[model samples]
Target: MKILSLPSSIGLASKIAKNIGCGVADYKLTRFPDNEIYTKIDTPLDGEDVVVIGNTNTDSDIMSYLFLLDAAKEQNPKRLIALMPYFGYARQHRVYNRG
Candidate 1:
């Protein structure tokens, strides 16, 4: 098992990895000129379980998490998991009725 740590959730990722006794995966994240998110997985995740950790505190954070997941999936990991410690959504937990 491996954990892919996003910039905003590095600390949490480390804690989780330590607790789970799993290794942290190597990856790179950058931004484009237009402020787009870019993710690169340096370690191959073939046949490995992957955990992506991040926070959705802003638009970029959400995009970063999505892009990271996509990159991890491309490596063909056995399973993909998401750990969101901080989601900035105001009411995502509540179901809304038709307006």
Candidate 2:
């Protein structure tokens, strides 16, 4: 029963995963010389349960979530759980102030 914990930032999510005795996998990401971003996951994820941890404090984090979701799907994991400590813009629940 192995868990693949992937995080966007090491400061928040990784710290929690570490405390819980879970192994962290690095999803290699960097900005190129031309200011273009690149990312790659070099972990063995065959038939493993993958949990993606990320924050939605910024728009880029949402994009990163999409990327991680797609990667998890491609890896064909047994199960995928998305843990978002900070979820994005769900603050627009009001409709025309119809209270």
Model 2 TM-score (2 dp): 0.72
- Compared with the true structure, model 1 gives a TM-score of 0.86
Look at candidate 2 and tell me the lDDT of residue 38: 59
TM per prediction: 0.86, 0.72
**Where is model 2 poorest over a 10-residue stretch in terms of lDDT?**
1-10
Residues 1-99 of candidate 1: C-alpha lDDT, one tens digit per residue: 999988788888888889989988999898889877788999989999999998999887888889999999999999999888887785776879765
**C-alpha lDDT of all candidate models, in order:** 0.89, 0.66
User: Given candidate 2, what's the lDDT at residue 56?
Assistant: 72
Q: Pick the candidate with the highest TM-score.
A: 1
| Residue ranges of candidate 2 with Cα displaced over 4 Å | 1-9, 31-37, 95-99
- Using lDDT, give the best candidate's number: 1
Query: What global local distance difference test value does model 1 have?
Result: 0.89
Prediction RMSDs, each to the true structure: 2.7, 3.6
